[model samples]
Target: MNTRKILYQFGYRRCADQDRPSPARHPVIVVGAGPVGLCTAIDLAQRGVSVVLLDDADRIGEGSRGICYAKRTLEILDRLGVAKPCLEKGVTWKLGKVFQRDDQLYAFDLLPEDGHKMPAFINLQQYYLEHALVERAAELPHLDIRWRNKVIGLKRRNDGVTLTVETPEGSYDLDADWVVAADGARSALRGMLGLDFRGEVFEDRFLIADVKMKGDFPPERWFWFDPPFHDGRSALLHKQPDDVWRIDLQLGPDADAKAEQAPERVIPRIRQMLGHDAFTLEWVSVYTFQCRRLERFAHGRVVFAGDAAHQVSPFGARGANSGIQDAENLAWKLALVIRGEAPESLIETYDAERSAAADENIGHSTRSTDFIAPRSAQELRFRDAVLALARHAPFAKRMVNSGRLSMPSTYETPLSTPDADEWSGSVRLGAPLPDAPMRNGHDQTVWLLEALDGEETLIHVPNGGTPPAGRRVLVIGHDLIDQDGFFARRFDATPGSTYLIRPDQHLAARWRHTTPEAIERASRRLKGLDGEHA
Candidate 1:
């Protein structure tokens, strides 16, 4: 089937141009209708903020790019009300095996323990995910998505930003309180703002093929170093929905990208790997990898997210996952600032937090690229030795880095209220809330994360103590029952312990015992109101 036909079937409709005059101003304007842009618009709209989403194209993504979504990303999507469709249409897996020239070196289980709500990773085509997000965006009344709307120019102001949008009929001007640029790696908005990325561009290229075939390959990730079937380089295989599989083949810098993508060249390669299995090529692309990011994500009235803020190698699947996290991190802060509920300085925390995450992703992606495509002979020999030792030596197995899979970045900032006492669990104050099963007041089993409905929640493990009173702060003990003790063991909760959770479900502060005054103080500090906390 043709790729365009698949995209059309997924409901990519051309939006009508506005016949009326453009609005004088919008609360938020999101550039690019890709996953990150659509997610940002949806998040802000869900928070009661009006948003306008723009995209140059009238369809979803063209190919199966960024096919892997991490668990943390899935949680963020769940909050956005699209995780159910994503989970149903994607292939979930946690086990991955690494091979060195057809010999299995070792295997790893990303989530060996059960009790978590989401899997380690899900493999779904980016187009499918984006289509789902667009459908969800349509259900919201506060979000206005304009297709074939291109951002031709932008000017940042002290109070707001003005953008020149070009539609098929004509061009119009739009003023926005805030601008979120998710236009992707080669962002036109970034170029218009005279911003550039600073980092290393590896001298290695990769070929990606989306092949459809009837096969029995398990849903686990399989990676190989110098595979015998392909050339002496790295390769990766992942299963997606619709009997389509994603395959990556390493092509040296000097390889001809066009020639490699040709059917005459790709068919023989697939035959060699699948041993003459019947298959059809769905899509193909060749591109180099770069580990790069802008100096700052937030620039005055305009901000950047996803590929516009940072670009990483595909080895770790960090691009879209981190981008979704970026949308989650920025949405609440932006909404608060726009509604005058928080000071403008609160937006600065988005930079401090996401920049740290970008650095972590870049560091890991760079290392993975170096290990997969070593430049020097000495480096290759060292990598080979480590791979050989990983077959038997358990210690060496830990050193093998086949793309240190994507994980959430812990933010150590003033926005997070540190623990006043020692803790003995994996979940920390600055980290996102770990998932656990719980029973609600109606005796319905639900995940702990489900209780956090985009609002600040105060959790207390009752020990014959009265709970605090607040207007918007949800008291969990009143409606939640931890019948299985999973929350206690996972969070190290004790009698009289109080935990303050932020709107994004991240732990803001925790204390052995606390009063309502202390909780209010921490909450104020989280919004950048308290001087000392700021």
Candidate 2:
């Protein structure tokens, strides 16, 4: 059996030529081919918008970074046509255990209810997730992913943006009607624009090691606060695909990152945790936590998403998940603006919605970071007291923030129309459409989300007649059976309730009974259009 680690590389193709005639202007140019950029490009392409994706690297992420993916991210991936492979290759876990100094404090389950299509969380190597996105992007003809193409300079023009991309052959100029910077946290594009990212950088550092080991440890997240093996520090263990485990150990602010990553120092720590079990170290990295975001995600014709827009501590797995959501939110809006279906003012809402999401992620990440790494002795004592009480006290259990974990951010923006009639369920305006099992006209089981199919739709529960002209209506009872009553219950649907859903699957508005005129008004408002023309 081979112990060597296999790294997959997506070979680079030279698409930019300095010697050729002036390049054609693309509708959209997405910087960075990471998950966010790839997803954004694929989404726009699927919406019939041609996109050019540029990345400096020819390969996916090297290590098992960002192992935990939330259900919302999975749902977004489902629409991108890569969720099936991701679900198959990922480790799904909902239970998490927290400990204090070798004693079990409490354990909790993330998803206590059912009826949803996806699980609460899945642990998958970032590389695998990126591979899936890349494969999906390749299937779309309108998406051109050019690897090893670095953007060295950018200028926001009146009508579009011009980017100077450096390829292996030579540097060439590329112009785009709009630019999306989904590059990583150290975004060159962000720097080129002379923008500043503001927030706090925690003094603590953490060592992340991915080890291949055959162990009896169950597939769950285990967090230890000051375990006996590594005194006075916290450790986290998460199971990933391919029998590899991700271990994150907290090292104080002053610890030497280089020395901590040395095999001699890391091997002994692993030996203590696993009790001399046989394991091979696959990857190791030391990182500091920072909760930061740009003041605005959209800057003129150039927009930002993923780490380029906001960055948070790794504790909550918010970084990648939030970035994916950012891509999901911006892709449809950009497509609409590019196609003239919506006004360019709709693009400003992207800044409004995603910047709020960035703030939410940053806040959660900061709190989780503070809980895990208390700033003072009094704070540490308070954390320990909460952990101790969590062992038996129900109230204390809720206070334990090993990491609040990632959840989808609901937008309270001008786009989402407030509920016109009273509703009973948790799915509200500005929320992602909840998933429920149903049987389509073909009499085969299907998910309500699958029926959405990335289109702006109006779902009329218990069957309503044809909607207004140009509106796509999916009558629940006529087109699909609400199997198990899940759809009705989850959506709080009354007999005549009609739901208006956006192309990104977010709930735009709902009413007990509405007219075509009302629906059209709400739809137009959702696109940032005004007045009688709307």
Candidate 3:
């Protein structure tokens, strides 16, 4: 998409906090205005918490960065009331095909089901997403977005964090009961606190060229390994909105970084790949990726999320997708802790769960890099053998590393109650509730996730039984009908099968038969208020 067509700028406006005798304290001050930061602020604002979202820039970013939005992220956007614009303005795809030497290895379907509210993935430019989020933030009365406001200094104390925010008018002391550092990878707050990442920076470089063209290519992820056009290197192609296409060509370690991005150097490469000269270059950049993250996401009163706390190689589209999930994971718990509804120690689970997810993304990305740009001759031979065998050998197809597309991480956290009964199926503890199509009492179609909404919920699939009292319960047989067998087959639903889900829609506990006492116990356990656990 042409950025100038949708370009917008926010002017400087003095804040009440800036004019106060002593800077007024906010319930939460988010230290960036990117998609992750904006989502975090909106999530908190929806829960009735006051938020100040600050960013160093006055407008959306320049390039079409992070075009792939996983289904899980789209669900989160639905909760924020901004998924409609994204679905209307983005390209949706699910088929992924892998090739080697101009030959097809195999194709896989990400979401091969019939009853889903959202698609497997949507390819929307990063700037478009930021615009949608900014609009949603403006709708919430509790959210205040401060453009061109940067957090240059941070001090963490025993109780809260105080920040030095610099703006066009002047610098001011902003005290926040809690701080969210969603700045970019070069996080100023992280540097102010003297924290460094720990992991490896790959030696290979890749070029991202966003091209505008009219082509007949289907909306599918096409990954090539050692293609004839770009001999002995990898290339990836994806379609974005407004006829914009994202192309990534792997450059070996020996490539000259400065000269590779010149129009003269880039245009010929495009011509060679497309066998014509009919495409216009939109954005171009050479990037070297790394697999790294902080030792911990939570440090005292200043907690980190998104790129500020972790980073991954661009393969797999994990960077932005995982960062959005981090915002969802931290938003509810942080809001609860601030409201005194949950123990302070509950914040530690955010670090534990998302750190595990970061490690998983880094592992997948690191392996994809190693396979695409092998570090040694032996590894190259192994990759070649796997590619050759993938044509017929089903086992070898799983070995291809064209970036394992992003998926929701099944967390191993302290909040989940161990399954007390013998459950069969993919229902795991601490996993996000898999979505299904359902019908409400009015006989209108709805989604399972949307019915639960953004609050702690009780789901009961009854077998000619009524729901238990003492908690708000959604009885499936009465409140809604399972239009499809997804929930029934997945949860192995029987008479009185019950589930307790957290505010973020993750499964906290389950049983074939549950009582009011069990529901209260699980609620306490989810908040980290259990006497022994806390």
Per-residue lDDT of candidate 3, residues 1-534 (tens digit)? 233343667888888888888967888999989889999999999999999998888987588878999999999999999999999999999999999988999999999977778999999999999999999999999999998888888888888888988898989998888999999799999999999999998889898899999978899999999889999899999999999899999998878877898889999999999888999998888888889999999998888999999999898999999999999999999899989999888889899999999999999989988888899999999999999899899999999999988988988876777776888866778888888888889999889999999899898877765677766688886787886777887777888888998999889999888778888888998887888542
Give the Cα-based TM-score of candidate 3 against the true structure. Answer: 0.97
Cα lDDT tens digits, model 1, 119-220, are 899999999899899999989999998888889999989999999988767787888999999999999999999999999998788888899998788999
List candidate 2 stretches off by more than 4 Å: 1-6, 16-19, 462-469
Per-model root-mean-square deviation over C-alphas:
2.2, 2.1, 1.7
Candidate 2: 10-residue stretch with minimal lDDT: 1-10
User: What TM-score goes with each of the models?
Assistant: 0.96, 0.96, 0.97
lDDT at residue 94 of model 3 (Cα atoms): 98
What lDDT is reached at residue 196 by model 2? 87
lDDT of 1 at 313: 93
Q: What is the C-alpha lDDT of each candidate?
A: 0.87, 0.87, 0.89
By summed lDDT, which 10 consecutive residues of candidate 3 come out lowest?
1-10
**Residue 282 displacement (Å), model 2:** 0.3
Winner of 1 and 2 under TM-score? 2
Best by lDDT: 3
Query: Top TM-score: which candidate number?
Result: 3
By summed lDDT, the worst window of 10 consecutive residues in model 1 runs over 8-17
Q: Which regions in candidate 3 have their CA more than 4 angstroms from the true location?
A: 1-6, 464-466, 532-534
